[model samples]
Structure formats: C-alpha cells, structure tokens
Target chain A: MFATKLKTQLLLITILPLLLTIAVVSLFILFDVLDSIESEVIKRGDSITDQAAVMAEFPLYTGDVDALQEVADLLIKTHDLNYIRFVDVSGQLLLTENNGNDKGRLREFSSPVFSQAPDLDDFSAPAAVRAPLGSVDIGFTDNSAEAQRFSAYIKVLSIALVALALGLLLVYLFSRRLNEAISSLMTTAERLEQKDFTARVEENGSGELRNFQRTFNDVIASLEQNDAELQQKINAATASLNESVEQLSEKNQALAQQRQETIDLERSKAILEERERIMRDMHDGIGGQLVASLAMLEREQDSAVKENIHAMLTESLNDLRLIIHSLSMQNNVLASLLADFKYRTSRRLEPLDIELDWLVAPEADSLSIKPQTGLHLLRILQEAFTNILKHSGAGEIRFRAGQQQEDFLIEIEDNGEFHPDTEAMSRGLGIRNMKSRAEKLGGSLNIEKISSGGCRLILTFPATP
Target chain B: MTRLLAVFFLLLTVLSPVHAGSVHIVLSADSDSHLQAASDIKAELEQQDAPPPVTVRLLKPFQSFQPAADDLLVTVGEAATRYVSQSYSEHSQLYSYINHMALPEPQAKHWASVMLDQPLQTLLDSAVDIVEGRYHNKLVIAVSEENQSMRLQIDQLTIPDSVELEVLVIEAEAEPAKIIDQALFNAGALIALRDSRIWSGETAKWMLYQSYKYNVPVVGYSQSFLKAGALVSVYASLRDIAHTTAQQIIGWQNNQGRLTQEGILYPRLSIDYNKNIARALNIPLPESMTAGEQNNVRD
Candidate 1:
C-alpha cells in the first residue's frame, strides 16, 4: 500500500487533503448548525411559556378553570408545544393540555403567572414585584433540529465526495502523463543498449523526468562521439596494416630478386675462375711446348717430316688457347674481352713481325654483356684471329668497338694478300664457325677485303646483350 | 387692659379665617340616605367657614352643571360621585359613597375621595381584638379586581403580630367557590374587601357559604356582607363619609389647595359583628364590637 504506483500515490496525495478539509469543515458546520438549532428551540420554548403565562394570568388569578383550559388548548394548537399545564401557587393543577407522545424528547418551559402587569424593563430581570399566583409549564420537542442536522450531513458528505473525485481526477491525469514520459525514456534507453546512438526521448515532463530525458540524450550524444572516434581509429589501423603488408611484400620480392642475383653472380664467378685457371694452364704448358716444338722444327731446316709435325702442333695449341680464352672471358664486357683479344693477338703478331691496332670507345666500355653472349663473341673473335694468324699471315691487324644507334659495334681489319677464292673460304670450317658465333651473339659477321689490308672482319650486337 | 387686648386679638383671630371657592354638595338622589349625608357635609363645611358658601344639589332628576377651578364640588353616593368626578374633573372635588371609582379615570390631583370602607389599620385592630381569645392561625386578606385598591392600601399597613396575612388577589370573572377555597386555606379568619364584581348577590353568597363550609370566619366591608354569612363587618356609613370629607376640605383649604394626603381617603372606621354568625361558628365576639364608629382613624 505504501509503495504503490505513481498514479495511486498522486491520487492519494491530492484526495486525502481534500477529504480531510471537507470532513473538518463539515464537522464544524454541523456543530454550529446544531448549536443554532438548539438555541432556536430554547428561545421558542421560552417564548411560548411566556405567552402562556400572560394568557393564563387572568384566568388563574380569578380561579377560572375553563378559561385556563381554553388558553392551554389554544396554545397547544397554535404553537409547537407538546403540552401545557397551569399550576396554582397552592399546588393545584387548574388546567392542562397534553398532546405530545414522546416525553423523552420533550423540553419543559415554565413561567410565573402574576396577577398584575410585570415590569419588562430588563428581560433577564427577576420578577421581584409580583409573586407567582401560579405557574404555566409548556413542553416541546426537538424534531426540527434533528432534521436540520441530517440534511447538513448529507450536503457536507456530498461536497466532500465531489471535491475528492475532482482532485483525484486531476492528479491522475498529471501522473499518467508523467508515467508516459518515463516510459518513453525507458524505450530510449533500450535503443541505446542496441547501440542506436540516434535514438532520442521526448523531453516533455516535469522535474526529474525532464532532467532524465536530457541526461539520456546527452549520454547518447557522448556515446555517438565515442563510437565515431572508435570507428575512425579502427579504419586508420586497418589502412596502416594494409600499407604495411604491401610494403612487406614489396620488400620480400626485392630480397628474393637480390638472392637470385647473388646466386647468379656466384655461379658466374666460379665459371670465370675455372676458365682463368684453364687459360693459365694452357698458356704455361701447352702453348709454351708447342712454341718450343715449332722453333725446333724451324732449326731442322728442309726436313719434310719435321715441318709437318710443327704445323700440327701450332694448330692444336691455337685451338686450345682459343677455347680457354672463350671460357675465361665469358662474363666480361664486350669491350674488355675485345681488349684482351687484342693484347693476345698483338703478342702473337709481334713474334710474327705483324703490327696490331686496338680501339674501343669509353661509352662502349659500360655496356653490359651477358656471359653467354660474351663467350660467343670471344669465340668469334678467336676465330677471326686464328684466321689472321694462319691463313692471312697479315703483318698488322686493327680492331675497333663502339656504340651504333641501339647496339654495340666491333670491326677487325688486317693487311694480307687477297685471293679471289677468299669468299669461297667462308664455306670452310673456320669461316663458318665465325659466322655461327656472330649469329649466336645475336649479331652479324662480315668479311671484306680492305684496300690496304689483307682481309676485314665486322661483328655487331646489342650493347647490353 | 391686657385682658381686653387678648380678647380683641381672639375675636380678630376668629373673624379672620381665610376662605376660597364655592362648596357644592351633589347628591345621587333625594333619598334619605343621600340627602342626609349631603346635608351633614354641607353643615360641617359651613360650620368651618373656610370655603365659599355651600350649595346642595340632588342628582335624582339629573341636572347639568359646571364647576370653577377653586370651587369645591362635594359628591355623595356612587352615581353622583362618578358623574361629578367625570364632568368636573378639573375642579377641586371631594367624592364619598363610592366603593371604588378607578382613581377617577386618568386621575385628578385636585380630586380626593372618602371611602365608605374602613381603613386597614382599624380593621386589623378590630380583627386582633375579636380573635384575641380565640385559637387563631393565619389572617387571610382577599380582594377582586373591583376592590384592587384595598389590596394596595392593605399591603402598606402592618399586620398584628402572631397573625400571618395571606393576600389573595382575585380576578373579576373568577369562580367564587374556587377563590374562597384558595383564600381560606389554613386561614383562622378571612378579611373580604368590598367589590361589586366579587360581592355581587350570587357570588357574595357563594363566597360566604364557601368560607363557612371551610370553617373559616370572614370579616366583611358592609353590613349586607355580614348578613350574607360573614362573622364580622367594619365599614363607614354615608354620614361618617360626609364628616370625613368636610374635614379633608378644611385641611385642603388650610394647606393651600393641596390635600393633606394624596389619592382617595377613607373615613373614620366602625366595627359591627353578627353575633348569631359568631355563635354559629362557636366564636365569641369582642366587647368593643359595636355597630357605630369606634375609632376616628382615617387614611
């Protein structure tokens, strides 16, 4: 009962005071009305007794019983008297008229019957001048007072009920509106639990309810701000992670390519070292023995078998030197290999009393060349040199290498006796080998007779092949 | 010479009495009773020689007359008294023979009355003397509306010791038996004042009979009341009223137009008792219970 709903509490708060006020006022009015009614009854009874005393004065004084009876009967009929009795001073009951039945409710009023006119100057003054010849007693009832009290009770109770009802109605309406406002706030809170920061409650109530709505909205706005900041942070972190992943992939790819390039470099270095070692062995052992043998054969002078053996040893050593030079120079630049070839051929030509010219462009020196292409170019160059040393017997040779439009250019020219059948010499194994080496280098080889030379050789390929 | 001067002063004193106004004696009728009382009053006033010359008028044949302010109008009997007091209320008048005249109807200061009833003092004295040897308890004084003045007059008088006076005031239209029954309660003797309303032929007989039935002796105002079964009677006759009226006129003349006392005045009292009635009640009458004036007391 004490912790009832808001509506019932409001109803009680509004109606209890109204009921209390009505009850207190009704009690006050009822008591006042009863007092007034009793006063009127007393005044009326006193007045009736006074009148009866006056009327019975003459009859009682003269001992007129019939006249007194008449007066008493007249009083009972006219006024609200229940009964009236005239008793003489001698205690004689001269006349009486008793009409009332309810003796318990009757109020008796008595007045003195004097023979002479009394002094009425003071109404409350004692009748000192005239003694009572007799006295008249009149009886009355309080029916009207009771009826008035009953009527007042009904009216007061009705007013109290009406006021209570009106007050309760007003309180109920106010509390209902308050409850609805709170319910709206409850729903908004539910939506907030679902992370719907856009949800809002209507801020329409009094006092605490209004404050609650404002606070709820404020909290939701704060949450929305926090949510937006958190979402931005998440997106930023994801983007940063993606960028980091992409950078890591790129770095991994670069690292793998570097590893492969290192492996290729190692392999190429090993092959180049092996080829150098072979080139050294050939130059120290086989090439020197062959040269000594060829010199011994020259000292034999005019022996047919010794001249044949010297020719065989020189050819075999040249071939073995050519193979070693190709292997050793496989990873070198075209210009560097060409310079090496020029030095080697120039040394050989000095012994043979031939002058060699080597020319290479500085711009062509930076041109990268693959190992296979360098090897192929070296073999081709060897073939050309061998042709110069064995067939042309040219005293001096000239070599040049530089950049053309998008390719490297190499040319070799030597002075030698020209033969009509030199073109037919391309069909020979040595010329064919030179042509094949140029093709393998993705270049063209051409042999032409120079005007002041024995023969001309040209080779062209891409600069960084 | 001193004796002769004294005689001369005495003769001058007798001849030099002051006189004022005419004295007119009006009688109700030429009946012996009224005429004799009228003549006696006239002679008494004339012997005093203190007022104007006296004149007598009998009202049996009804004469119309007017009186001056200082003229003395002496009325005898009830009819002549009411007529003169009513008609000539402004004149100095003396009224007698009337039992009760209602104070002259709005009252005149110049009018004085000599009642035929005895004064309360004389009646009480006579009652005390009569009931001296008897075993008495309480004295009852009763009156009707017509005799209301006697009640007032008796109330001012002191009653004898050893007697409780119960004053009963009766109305005019009362039942005599009922009034007598209330008045005679524990009464040793009853004093009944004369009133035409109560002492009428029928009610008077009824009251006397009721008093006798209650074994209470009654003192009445007139001899007729005595004859109606009352034990004693004390009253003033017309002649006595006339003599008292004359003395009042002389006193008024001496007092410069003011009566010696205000209101109506009564004559010297006389006592009369019915011996037969007293014997019937088994009560002895006093030796002084005579029929004529025994005391000159007047009020």
Candidate 2:
C-alpha cells in the first residue's frame, strides 16, 4: 500500500510550494492593483472637489447661487462625479449639480470654499488664513475601480492556475522518469532474489537517479560474474568427486576378490589337515597292532591260539578296508557311507557264518554329515559288529537307517540265542568304545534285547549336526 | 618746465593726505539689510569728488567708539544707532534704518536718523485705497497698549470722510485672538501697525485669521505683512532706506560733518498690493493706484 510513497513525496515537494507561491503572488498583485484603483478614484475625487471649492469661493461668499451653480455644473460635467453641492458657511446649500450616472459604490470628498489669502514669496511670512466662504461636496463612484479590480482578479487567478498546471506537468514528467528508474531497480532486485544474477536495471533518468541505475547495474554485473566463477568451481569439484568415487569402487572390488581367494586356500588347508590326522591315527593304532599280532603268531604253541590270532588278523584287515572305503567316498552322505559299511560287514559276517540284514531309508540316504561325524559313526558301527561276531553267538545281524523328524536313526540287531549279562557287557571294552563313539557323533546309543531274543543297538543324531 | 611740474606734484601729493578725513559706518548686525545700508552709505561717500576714507564695522556688545571730531560716524539699524548715540554723544552721528517709533530723540545738533516706518497718514491712505470703497466705510487700527501715543497720533490725523478709522489698543499679554475678533467685528478693513508687541509671532497669525474670518481686508505696515495675507502694505523698503541713508551720509560729508536733515527723517516710502487677497475679498483696486511709481502689485 505504501509502495509509491517516494513518488507521492516527490510530487508534493515540488508542487505544493509552486501552488502556494503562485496563489500568494497572484493575490498580492490583485490586492495591490485593487488598492491602486481605489487610490486613483479617491485622488480624482479630491482634486475635483478642491477645484470646485476654489471656483465656488467667491460665488458662495457673495451669495450668488447662479455662479455657484455654474461652477458645480462645469465640474460635474467634466469629471466622473456622481454629484456636486455648494454649501455656504451657514450650512445652507446654495447650488447642487448631478451628472446622473450613479452606479456601484460611492466615495464622497469635500473641500472648504476658502477665500485664500495671496501667495507670499517671503520665507518668514505667516501662513495664509483663509475664510471658509462655503464648502463643495462631490460624490464620486467606485464603479470603474471595481471593474478594474475584477479584471485584475480574473487575470491573476488565470495566471496562477496556468502556472500551477505547468508546474504539475513538469513535476509529473520528472517524477515519472524517476519512478520508472526505481521500478526498474526493484524489478531487477526481485530477479536477483531468485538468483538470476544476470538481471540488470537500465541506466535511465538524470542526476542522482541515473547514477543510482548505473550503480545497480554495476553491482548486478559483479554478482553475475561472481556467480559464474562459483559455478565453475562447483563443476570442477563435482567432477573431481565423481572420479574419486569411481577409483574407490575399483579398489573395493579388487580387495573383495583377494579376500575370497584367501578363504578358499584356508578351506583346502583344513581338509588336508583332517586327512593327515586320520592317517596318523591309523598308523599308530591298527598298523602297530597288526605288527604285534604277526609276531605273536610266529611264537604260538596251541592250535586254538593260532586260530584266534588268525581271526584277529582278519578283523584288523576288515577295519583297514572299511577305513579305506570311507576315505574314498566323494561326499559325506550318510546312506552311501553306511551302505559301504554294510557290504564290508556282510562279507566279514559271512566268513563267520552269520546272516546280514541291511535296510536304508531313502530319506536317510540323502542326509549329509561332516567328515569327522562320519568317521565317528563308522567306528561305532565297527565296534558293534565285532562284538556281535565274537561275543554274542548271533546267527543274523540287522542294520537299519531312517529319518525321524529332524533326527537320523540307525539300528543294528543280532539274533544268536545268547543272553549276555548286562553288567558284564557294560564293563566290556567294545561296548564302552561303541558308546564313546556314539557320544562323539553328537547322538545317543542304546543296547537292548528284542522280543525275539536278539540284541538291538540304536543310534540317534540330528541330520544337520 | 620740469621744476614747475615737480613742485606741483609735490604740493598735490602732500595736500591730498591732509584733506582725507576717514568715515566709519557701524552696523547693528551682519544682517543683509544692515550690511546693505552700510555698504550703500560707504559707496555714496566714496563717489564724491573728494570722498572721505570710509571704513565699515559691526557693532559688538558694550563696545566703545572714539571718533575724530572731523570724522563722520554713520550707524545703521536700531542697535547700532542706540549704541553710537549713548557712547559717542559729541560725535557727528547719522542713524539710519531704525523704526520711527523706536528712534531715540536727538542729543546733539548734528545727530539725525532715517526712520524705517512710513508716515502713519501714508499707511492709512493706502488702506483706504485697498478697500476701494468695498468695506462699509470702516477702517480698524490695531495697536498694542504700549503704543498709545501711536494711537493718539492716528486719532489726530485728518482721515478721508469716506473712511471711519477705529483704533484698537491691544494690551500687552492679552489674548490677541479676542482683540483681533473685537477689532474685525463690523469693520470693512483692519490696519496692522509696526508695533511688534501687537503684531509679532502668533498674535500676528491670529490677526490675519480673524481678518479673514470677518471678511475684512488688512493693510499692513511692511512688505512681509503684505505677503502674510494683508490686502495692502505701506513701508520703506531696505533699498529706499539704504539710498536715503547714502544720501544723508553724502549730505553730512558735504555739509561740514553735519546732517542735511535733522530729527527723525522718514525715508522714501513704498506701497505693495496683494492682488490675490484683493480679489479674494472682492475689493476692486483702482488702476491709478496699481500704476503708480511707488506701487508694487504682487499677484
């Protein structure tokens, strides 16, 4: 609402005084002219009255009304007098004349009809003491003065109005140029707010306004130049940042590939370590025992003892074969390893004249286990089969493998019509060894007699464990 | 011939100094009238075939004068005349330019004065002539009480039968307006005297104003009064007095250091008319009076 305050202020500053000065000067001139007209009218009236008095002095003193009338008539006719009257010193009107042209206002002037003494040239001479024979009163009208005053007023007012109008026109023209300059600056300023630094005001107008426009344009130009330099710096920084990010990404990929190769090398080293451990255990346990048994066989005296030595030799050889078979398996599938173990055990049992029964569930055949768990399960099965072959006089041995929920279950049964003492079996090394192997496999082991009078051994472990 | 000529030049040069008697003229003031009278006297004395050595001097207060018995002393104006009369009684003194009423009586046989005032009868006759029979046969004379002798003199004069002279003796310190009003009442004309007590300062102005108020013409004693609204005035002009004084000095010098006229001698008189005042009063002036040698008509 107050946006155009400068324009309003500028117009007022220029026009108000112009209007006031014109009005004041015009009024002064009008009053002066009017006063001059009034003064002229009064002076003319006084002059005519004085002349009439001088002419009527003798006539009025002599009481000659005719002569007084002539003097009054001559004055009234020649001058612009409303009326003329000659009055004697006794206050009696002797003669009166009127031009009959009374209009507008009237101003009356009077002079005594003095019988003036003679003029004296002497400096010390006394002032003339004249008798007032009578008086002459003349009436003059101000109609002409009023007319002239009216004409002057019209002229003064017209001139004042014209001057005021001219002043307003000039002010408006000058202020328009100034406002245009200011508006242009404001518009450019708004553009600068929106960050359009290229915006600039036109250098228009004169004097200070023109200088202001030029200064604004110079500032905008400087800002535009600065913005261009800033944009260039930002672009250069962005490009440098993109290049750095791409190099970091390549370095991360190379580091990831090197980490993956190191992990594969660690896994191969662990598998080789497990194989060396298994070979060392075999060299120290079964290989040494075979050497001792050969020595004993060479020194045996009884034939039955010789047969025992031959049986021990055959079991060791069978254990060695089972170890070889387990080592040669491609994957750690429990069913494949268990099937190999059943074939090896059946051959050993057939030499001993015992029947072999093997049942492998399909779900149990796909179950995978760690290599160490497979070795523990095979060792436990070997211990149970040897016990069945040597201690339990069993004619047939049954083996079964299946899955129950998340667990894998394996059962081995022997039917030999022999009831082994529980306490004695618990104390036996083979039974203890079998139990120890089952515990290592993270499973449970149980030995019991079935209804058909055969011993049953059950092993249960988690399939993923 | 050379011897006779040398003897004659010697006798002429030696005798010229013996016959040259100096004349001293004393003035009352450095006033133009007094100076003019003194200069005229000196000039007239010098114009003689055997003129005396003349010197003019201004009279100082309380100053004494000692003149040779053969040397003549001329005093101009009232102060110088009075001063020389009292201080140098035995000297041959000629007093000029003093008012006739103000002149002192002669103390020696050769002492004389040229009076400034015109004869009273001459002033009255001029007043009569100015009225021109317009006023109702009445002429008023205004004088101060100090000058009762002047009023008596006017009473003793033989006035024209057509003119009735009325004398108004104004008292000293009295209101001049009342006196003038009384004097102008029913009078056709007023005659102003030379008495300063009656007609000087504001009293003089009141007299003129009352004279106009009554429509009465005033005949004054001096030219100044004539200019001051008087219809007519009769007096001795300064030139007339100066010429008479010069003639008297010449006569005294020629008559063996004694004045030709004795006592208070009146100078040649002059009459001046205010034509404008005469016309304003509706008094017609006779052509004979206007065309006279002594008449000076001021329009």
RMSD of each: 22.8, 18.2
The two-chain DockQ for each candidate, comma-separated, is 0.02, 0.05
Q: Looking at model 2 chain A, which ten-residue stretch has the lowest summed lDDT?
A: A117-126
Q: For residue A81, what is the lDDT in candidate 2?
A: 79
Candidate 2, CAPRI quality class derived from DockQ: incorrect
Residue-level lDDT of model 2, residues B1-299, one tens digit each, is 43443344334333533323456777676655555566566566567787666666668722644457676777877777787887777777888777756677666557877777777887787777765466476888877787865876787777888878887777777876676677677787888777767677645655787788688988877888766888877777776777777777777767877778877777776777788987887877767567875455221
Which pairs clash (backbone N, Cα, C closer than 3 Å) in model 1?
A: A354-A395, A415-A453, A415-A454, A416-A454
TM value for model 1: 0.33
Candidate 2 docking DockQ:
0.05
Backbone clash pairs for candidate 2 read A394-A416
Best DockQ goes to which candidate? 2
State the weakest 10-residue window (summed lDDT) of model 1 chain B. B290-299
TM-score list, all predictions: 0.33, 0.41
- Supply the global lDDT for candidate 2: 0.74
